[model samples]
Target: MGAEQIRRWESGALAHAVTDPFGQGPLPWLRGSEHYVDATGQVVPWYAEPDRDRGARGPRTADDVHRQIKGFAASGAVAPGQAIDFHITVDPPQQFSVDIYRIGHYAGAGAFKIITSPRLAGIVQPAPLAADRTVSCHHWWLSWRLQVPSHWAVGAHVAVLTTADGYRSHIPFTVRDDRPADLLLVLPDITWQAYNLYPEDGRTGASFYHAWDDNGRLLGERDAAVTVSFDRPYAGAGLPLHVGHAYDFIRWAERYGYDIAYADARDLHAGRVDATRYRGLVFPGHDEYWSVPMRRTVESARDQGTSLVFLSANSLYWQVELGPSPSGVPDRLLSCRKRRGPGKASLWREIDRAEQQLLGIQYAGQVPEPHPLVVRNAEHWLWEATGAGEGDELTGLVAGEADRYFPRTALPEHRRRILLAHSPYRDGSGALRHQETSLYRAPSGALVFASGTFAWSPALDRPGHVDSRIQRATANLLDRICKRD
Candidate 1:
């Protein structure tokens, strides 16, 4: 598309502007892969292709174990008409193809296949270059450059890279738009990059949280990276560890026809997004990292009556700063000392900015195993239906890391505060701990909710993990946020 055409599409001035077609009934354009049909029946799938092989599991070879086909997006997100570069490396030097899919509720098809690249030769890129406590691939060769189509819908997207030998991996990125929507879904891209230990060959992989000693002994925060780069692929299969949490929420929300826009966390730090423009800002995954500007913006938005929803635990815990890439692309480097260091990087709580002061509840402890989510304020509007009552326990609803209200912490002033779920779980040390899901109405009439468990979003849509009551409760919260209730 030409520059003017792309601009028109982004400005929503095109004759057939892309839109969320879910829950709009089965229109003629929804038939087949074409989610949007323009005049003269020009159909655009917009990455809505189902039945494409998205699996990366196969028999392993020396090349697969040592260096399988893997890649990373040059940027965490790209707007329509912008070109995104994929840096990929394939072992044994083989040809590969990339299939791009936009993730959403496509009438329950899960994703739409938007683009497929012609087969291209792939080469093993250079090894990761290690700097002071950091590993980066800024020198890797660009394998593919995709110019995002102007009419592509805004949502979470993934690129599946498959080699001639059937080895596959994924590269995830977001297609963003500048238009306003009822709610903004910000993916935890910074946290994803923080936990990525690329080149996990048992020798030189290091995230901001963990690393391996020269003797291959696993080391903790002390030996971890003080800074992490966005230029390297995620360890293992190139997928972020907690990405499914965000995807599950997206599938459920889109299925219900919520008006949602997507962006990466870095977008908030870069001031590319205006949180105040939306009714609610949704963080639907393991969003554990935060920059000063990001926190200030979200908090400022809340003070202005924009609701904030955190669907998982341990959010805004660590403070981070963004830096330019070695090549000077802004906000490509994430620096968090996680302790007293040369820069202002530490836990927000340690700096007297306890997350509870904003979230109403703060990180408490980790759940060693799944535990029932014991309902507390069952009479609250958040639990209006789905047959939940006080003391009712949703089996295995509380797991992974969790949060709870801290009595001594400086809490956010609110018109009303409620503890929705109080669940007991044993920690790794066999100590008794409790997790509490919280909801508080800010003085500005904005609602802030903390799910207090990592499993909340998974229960929204993941098969074998879905819970109707939890789903209903989440819908209630979101509906209230959008004033649809």
Candidate 2:
């Protein structure tokens, strides 16, 4: 059967009638055995479905993110007046301290911070796991009551977490002294097209799935490297599921602005969403796959001053669409069969236009082996503050073991484009391979910061403090684009 058929089957398109139509009550779940062992190991034939929908049990694994969130809600039995409690369980559980601050604009003071929780607390070291344990779980939890005084202008706040290694992570939450509306995060969902395999299933294996490179074993037949949750299609009605890279970016965006929102590209491709609402559009890490509508909407949004940031390299490579399906959500959305054959509009063309107007630099193509090291150009803005000019110092982050550049050219006539940064790109010293990252400004004044390197913000993951330069550079870009024309 085709993907469409699978969706229809999952959606109950073909239902079977029950023989006991005269049943006076709800039917019991059929079990082969007449009796069963209960949770307590006693002989109990049946018990309620373990009201898991409520605060049924504590989290057991890292996959309990959803359950932990539920336990904090009234429906989950967090007493009416009790504070909201949430927990994040991870493997190799580590301890960390997080401080929540209230950030907002009061009159003309601009953005200011007010300590909201735990009071002037210092570094909080988390409880360590058992010493004997080798492979267990770590659970980090934060619980607090909502109490914000009146007269505080509404805005967003940051939950700055500091790990033992001195690495700091930011989680954003909003504080409204008025009615609360859900904060929307617009994520470019690309979990379906997870791997970059040449022959589609080059690394495919049976028995068990191993997430190559990371060794973060997925541990299941359904656990494809895909980060976006696809356990059962449309399980959430395509409710803007964030995954992998997009999750990190959205978390970052929330700390800066609470108005950010996202929808799956497939949803947009299927015409199930309206993308014009957001004031800014963010294309996070390695968004190489793009349906026709995804490209068109983003392109249109950029022209209308919807600030676009392509925080990635080799983006928009594949051309996909909302495939034929009957499920509530779109199926077969991303359709770029790399080695399967080639045809139709290439992402190269899209990059060409984008470089001419918005983000500068058409993705020439992926660089081959023997990665070249990046050498700063005189025009690169990042070098101004570092005082590390050409041949003086090398960049901190490297791409693909070495740096790679996109194949680029000058923007079209009258197109004011700028090359922000570039690295020495050549084909293996033997082949004729050539690529470079060129930043440019469009005719409408939209700015693009292209850094042929894919590892643009690797410093963000450092285990203690955020790189001040990286933060400043990113913040500066946002400030520049959000300015009133």
Candidate 3:
């Protein structure tokens, strides 16, 4: 058998072996390869290296120094399923440790497979809570071997464990996988609205949560304590209140068959995307999070004829930084504003102003009103395309009047065809005026359709079918743009 294959079999079938060709085995090890032929002409074991391993441990050294793991290639690019080596070094003078822990989600939890030594994959992880590493030269080498899952969402956390003085220390290492800027769905780490308390402290800006039980179907509440929670404006109803928005958009978009990709704004700012790859971008659900670079990237792309679908509201408010964090969620410093309320100061006022002037939208304000009514904009092209009459339920996630949030004067002189003045016949705000959702558009074919009336998604929790006419219209609009020739 090859060295890679032998290592796999030995690691699995021959685990706990005290000593073998794989070296003094007994310490935990992780094997990335299935098999590799050895020089002895007999199938001998290969020591676990510090690259990426699933289930295994490291090879022990006598002098405590060796180059256990090293990089094979330096280029920041890879084709799917490409094979590469973890060029490792083991200095017998210094002790080294190799750890293999899943980053995104553990097995059977989510689709993506994350091995941190190289990098992370997927937006979340299963059992990616922690892993152990050894510190050497005052510099530790942490490696993870991961298999990229189909449709990976792109965000990661590492399980870090430091071994010294015969003791181990556990720490969480979070890393972002974004490398490009061009995408349609720039999804921020948004699980906070589903939690009882924001997972990280208010300082950590990651707003997302994920949990699963024995069966692994993403459990909502396992411990009876709060599994998830948000900062302010997200305390009540959780995501159930916004389930309608998710369901309706998915249903409509799927029906029309659009090429949609969900990405976080952090990725855009990092220049990880080749904007020429896709035609348009869509912001779905509560995309209230924003970073300065994210805003700049999107605006630049839009100006370059990349159609934008501002499906959600309260966007581009909080400017955040994307970097490493020793803690679970990383460092999040709020740099935006409240638009309303007492301490309200437009956080990234420039970005907000840019959106208003460019897209004809603004964060008018938020309200506590339920998704009671659906106002109509009969004259607008988006509405006219919907083929819906007046009195259609505008399923708003942050339901409020559209005109109140998106003012007409905000429209740039270039594009008036996209947005018609809110007919005075209605509340004169266009879509029911509200804070949570807003609407705006630019003349460059970029569009903003905010549903201020929140919860536009027909509620699955509701007894009868709710108003989904607007939902259908949204799907049609996206289909028209995304399907452009």
Question: lDDT of all the models against the reference?
Answer: 0.80, 0.36, 0.35
RMSD (Cα, Å) of model 3: 17.2
How well does candidate 2 match the true structure in TM-score terms? 0.47
lDDT of 3 by residue, 1-485 (tens): 32222232222112211111112121111223223343333332333232223322332211101111221111122223432222122222223232333222122121122443332211111111211110111022222343434443332222222222111211111132333333355444332232222111111111222222233222222221221111121211111223233333433443444555444444565576644355677665445555556677777766766766655445554444443323333222222222323553435544345455534464554433434344455555456555555554433333332223344445444444333222221232344443322344455565555443334433311213344555555655665566543
lDDT order of candidates, best first? 1, 2, 3
Model 2: residue 443 alpha-carbon error in angstroms: 2.0
lDDT of 2 by residue, 31-136 (tens): 1112444455445322123333443322121111121111111111111133333232222334444445433223322224454344222222232222211111
Best by lDDT: 1
List per-candidate RMSD values in Å: 11.3, 18.0, 17.2
Best by TM-score: 1
Each prediction's TM-score versus the true structure: 0.86, 0.47, 0.48
Show the colliding residue pairs in model 1.
47-112, 47-113, 47-114, 48-112, 48-113, 49-112, 49-113
TM-score order of candidates, top first: 1, 3, 2
Worst 10 residues of 2 by lDDT: 13-22
lDDT of 1 by residue, 110-142 (tens): 778888999999999988888876788889998
Superposed by TM-score, candidate 3 places the C-alpha of residue 250 at a distance from the truth, in angstroms, of 4.0
